[model samples]
Target: MGCEAPATVGKLVAVNTSGSYLWEVPLETEKPSGGFGCAPAAIPAAIYGTPAVEVEEGLVYVGSYNGKIYAINSSSGALRWVYPREGNLQPVVGGAVVALGRVYIGSSSGTLYALDAVTGDKEWEFQTGDKIWSTST
Candidate 1:
């Protein structure tokens, strides 16, 4: 998967230490951006931020400008689940944080969401009244 940020669709890649690919998964947006013709971003990202890899859980979590989050199998490219299986949220520009079986992330809508790591269910949410761009390191 190319890490270059795309306005519409991007990809998440798992590479070995030797710079070889282990797996690649596509990242898509539910809403299209106006800037669709530009080249990919130089930084490593699915669309806006770096993807979160949870090795112990065998899952890779990524957010898109389409306001959606996806959980993919770490070893395989199979998609495990997606958040807001129906509607959409503000664009998710930050990476996810996985701890204590919860996936925490922020969206452009000025809210933070804590989702069930396994099922992508909304566990809770907090409104900050401002866009959140930073991710936990």
Candidate 2:
């Protein structure tokens, strides 16, 4: 899949870092004249929840308003996979937490999902009576 950010103006973040950004969510991929090519996954429309990174696994996990959880390569920011591969999950309002071998995240639908850290596969889910807006510890 591909993403094109809206032309509308938004915040321009400036990070004082020792290295350049890991990657840019591409708006368009370069045309391959006659060779193999790779395209990054689509970016979410909005993100309220902070992202969690698994250093040892080399993955950065983040949930989006589009109701999906994404596992991106930490060094390249290339999307590795997304949860509920078919998407359409409840809006992930809370940040994700990586522990043991799972990624735990909550949604506005009051459901918490536990996914495999390496694959973004659902291991299990829990439903609460109210929306889950707090980040999991």
Candidate 3:
């Protein structure tokens, strides 16, 4: 799936599984900024689920099947930080939540993690009987 900003002259983001990529399209130019607009950099492993929580400034948080969560710059599609999964589980399907200077999301292994929103550093994690399929704040 793909999503574009609400026509306020910002970037558009599209995710596909074929190449594990994130593609960006400038609204005015219609020029594709391939692979999250990082030309020389490696493509993302696989973007899953829509990005959640466009936080302060240009920061946006998204989860991936690469078993990690990424904080990306909204306008430029640049990588700000990466939070890798520590447990033996993937971090897709369940979306992420941002609140009170932290990001919250669940893993497929029935665990939920709270991290510093800016740094991608783990603050805490709580495990539940069933996996957290969704979240809100």
Candidate 4:
């Protein structure tokens, strides 16, 4: 499962059905930046929703409040890839869906993204007028 706390970094935690910890992967941490005059000046990247697990591929997909989606190795707890290339921030409040060899997720920036499951390369994006905070169905 994925877990995170406010003002702290996110984590991909693996636990058995009995609730024993197996392993964990730490996510990227962001420093506080000047808000647009209303929001908090500083913000930390965090996981705010559930993760999508592809057991057959041994991968887990999760979105972060920091505007990133990650693919993590289930067995080794290693990071596979992150979406949006780099140096871009698009807070994702929704859970991700892995299907048809793609990862689908929405962002607070009001965009729905389709990314390559293996390389995290963006395949397509659709923009909305408002933030996309709902999970993909």
Candidate 5:
């Protein structure tokens, strides 16, 4: 996802999954700024799930295709923590369902995980049949 800085007008933020970098670009009226502003932030991997979820204390949670979920500082794009899942799973395209301080997500491995919303900690896992693709509460 891309966004402009709320404080600075015309400044843009771009997240690149393939390049694993977050770019900050300042929009200039006179000429092109060459897409430069702040340092590039490194993402966990390709993002495939729900976009970053803004939470309390200026934190943002994002899930990626690397089988890892990340909590990063929204303002600085600094990583606070990451929760890794089983990597061998094919993929999880359904995204995450957050409720009551918990995150629910399903993987192509035919399993579901309940995790702590704030810390990205896994609380439980439920395995389903091979024919099942996903589940919900």
Candidate 6:
């Protein structure tokens, strides 16, 4: 994956087992700047881990360091949906997993989220005492 600071643009690259580039999917647009009255602006979204692929569904799930999860079409490299449906400031350092028709991912905020695989709807969320930066088994 290619990621640059201050820019939300990142690429989810697919490589064949033979070390060949298969395809690449672009991430979200440039991140907006916002914070408390005088607090510093938050960092842009960036990919920091591997993506989870659901071969049966032809979908790939990836999380950004800026706290957004994306669902992309495996064959077309097109974006399907993004979690939170609005904001992009939650740092999701962990990878996502797909199972039972849902996508599971965690964030630096210590929240584990379960989203509908097809609709990107929030099914439920669990808060933890610390950040979850690893893939949920």
Model 5, residue 131: distance off in Å is 7.5
Query: Pairs clashing in candidate 6?
Result: 66-90, 67-90, 67-91, 67-92
- Locate the minimum summed-lDDT window of 10 residues in model 2: 27-36
lDDT tens digits, residues 1-137, model 6? 43334322456677678977777876664663432111144344556667889998899988986567889888888789988888763677768888999999988778899999987899999998887868888
Candidate 5's TM-score reads 0.54
**Relative to the unseen true structure, what is the Cα RMSD of model 1?**
4.5
Residues 1-137 of candidate 4: C-alpha lDDT, one tens digit per residue: 43233333346678889988777888777752422212233345556568999998899999877677889898888989887657755777789998999999988889888998888999999888788877888
Query: CA lDDT of 134 in candidate 2?
Result: 72
How far is 10's C-alpha from truth in model 3 (Å)?
22
The Cα RMSD in angstroms, rounded to one decimal, for candidate 6 relative to the true structure is 5.5
Tens digit of per-residue lDDT, candidate 1, span 1-137 = 43443333466667789988788776563335432323542222236667788888899888877778899998887899999897777777778889999999998778999999999999999998888987854
Show where candidate 4 strays beyond 4 Å: 1-10, 32-43
User: Candidate 3 — what's its lDDT?
Assistant: 0.60
What is the alpha-carbon lDDT for the whole of candidate 5? 0.54
Q: Between candidates 1 and 5, name the one with more favorable TM-score.
A: 1
What lDDT does each candidate get? 0.76, 0.68, 0.60, 0.76, 0.54, 0.75
Q: How many residue pairs clash in each candidate?
A: 0, 0, 0, 3, 0, 4
Q: Whose lDDT is greatest here? A: 4
Model 5, C-alpha of 34: deviation from truth (Å): 35
Error of 6 at 87 (Å): 0.5
| Better lDDT candidate (4, 5) | 4
What are the runs in model 5 whose C-alpha is more than 4 Å off?
Answer: 1-44, 85-90, 130-137
How do all the candidates rank in terms of lDDT, highest first?
4, 1, 6, 2, 3, 5
lDDT of 6: 0.75
- How many backbone overlaps does candidate 5 show? 0
Off-target runs (Cα >4 Å) in candidate 1 are: 1-9, 29-31, 34-46
* Candidates 4 and 6 compared by TM-score, better number: 4
